[model samples]
Target: AQTVTQSQPEMSVQEAETVTLSCTYDTSESDYYLFWYKQPPSRQMILVIRQEAYKQQNATENRFSVNFQKAAKSFSLKISDSQLGDAAMYFCAYRPGGGGADGLTFGKGTHLIIQP
Candidate 1:
């Protein structure tokens, strides 16, 4: 079984600053994909970033990026130039690479607080 863990239950960042959310996972499968999904108060899960286990380079999207350490099973999300709109619950997710696997295995999630 695969599992995702977000150590920090809550995180806060000042506007225009950067904040990193910690995440770790346990998995026996060698091939898999990691993802960071953001859910605002509206409750829609948005894909922030994604990383493939086989990829050496980390994945990035705009001000969002991931520090994916495959060997240590660590995948963290970094939000740069944070904004008030970025406030939300962020979840770390996992999905096996092979076909026929079920949906994502998600972490408990981290609630982000943005301060003006």
Candidate 2:
């Protein structure tokens, strides 16, 4: 069984600063994909970033980046130049790359609050 854990239940950051959200997972499969999804007030889960287990380089998208530690099974999301629009409930998800009966495992999520 695979599980995702977010140590911090909630976090707050001042506008224009940087914030890193922690995420760790346990999986038996060697090949899989990790994802960070953001859910705003509207409650829609949007893909923030993704990392392939085989990829050595960390994945990044504009102001969003991930520190993927495969050996430790730790994947953290770093949001730079935080803005009010960046506030959301971020979720860490996992799914096998090859596909299987296994469904996407998601963490409890970290609620990010942006302060002006």
Query: Which candidate achieves the best lDDT against the true structure?
Result: 2
lDDT of 2 at 103: 73
Q: For residues 1-116, what per-residue lDDT tens digits would candidate 2 score against the true structure?
A: 89999999999999999999999999989999999999998998999999999998999999999999999999999999999999999999998877657578999999999999
Per TM-score, the best of the predicted structures is 1
The Cα error of candidate 2 at residue 43, in Å, is: 0.9
- Pairs of residues at least 3 apart in sequence or in different chains that clash in candidate 1: none
- Candidate 2 matches the true fold with a TM-score of 0.97
TM-score of each: 0.97, 0.97
Alpha-carbon local distance difference test for all models: 0.94, 0.95
Q: Cα RMSD for candidate 2?
A: 0.9
lDDT per residue (tens digit) for residues 1-116 in model 1: 89899999999889999999999999999899999999998999999999999999999999999999988999999999999999999999999988786699999999999999
Whole-model lDDT, candidate 2?
0.95
Candidate 2 wrongly placed segments (more than 4 Å): none
Runs in model 1 deviating more than 4 A are none
